[model samples]
Target: MPVRILDSRDHVLRRKTIPMVKILWKNQDVESATWELESVMRKAYPHLLLPIERLIPFSGFCW
Candidate 1:
């Protein structure tokens, strides 16, 4: 899967209220990806809120 992340400041629809972390995943097989991400997030940032951006495909880069 290809993943891309953009900072809140770089997001197109920037919101001033909450800081955001964007996550994109490609070729993601449902269960494993979700669980893996959740596990990582739970351990890494236990308190901060994070929203995941689903299924973003690579447009201009090589794998």
Candidate 2:
């Protein structure tokens, strides 16, 4: 499960673009965070995306 969302960006493909987010997982270090598809996270872990502003307070991070 995700502990919080750290950042977000768009992935460009040959014919399309996919929204992605950097996810901080439970019991993991900040350096271990991974990028996941925004759509998938929204479906599986909606709560994590709901309070995005509150979750990412660090400078240089955007959601």
Candidate 3:
């Protein structure tokens, strides 16, 4: 599971753009953080994103 979100960015595919977040995993270092699709992460781990959404008012997340 992820410990926290370190950063975020947009991943542009051939005809679409997807929001991605750099996730810091439990028992891992900064260098080990991996970028994952925000939508998928939200579906898989809604609880993890709740605190971050509450902290950042304008994080650009719909929910």
True-vs-predicted CA distance for residue 23, candidate 2, Å: 0.3
Candidate 3: residue pairs that collide = none
Per-residue alpha-carbon lDDT of model 2 for 3-63, expressed as tens digits?
A: 9889999999999999999999999999999999999999999887776578667588477
Candidate 3, residues 1-63, lDDT tens digits: the string is: 899889989999999999999999999999999999999999999877776548777756596
- Per-candidate Cα lDDT values, in order, are 0.40, 0.91, 0.89
Report the CA-based lDDT of candidate 3 relative to the real structure: 0.89
Give the poorly placed runs of model 1, Cα more than 4 Å off.
Answer: 7-16, 26-63
List the candidates ranked by lDDT, beginning with the highest.
2, 3, 1
Q: Give per-candidate clash totals.
A: 0, 0, 0
Candidate 1 vs candidate 2, lDDT winner: 2
lDDT of 1 by residue, 1-63 (tens): 325432232223455333244444476543333223434444565543333423455468687
Better of 2 and 3 by TM-score: 2
Model 1 RMSD in Å is 11.9
State TM-scores per candidate: 0.22, 0.75, 0.74
Best by TM-score: 2
Candidate 2 residue-wise lDDT at 14:
97
* Candidate scoring better on lDDT of 2 and 3: 2
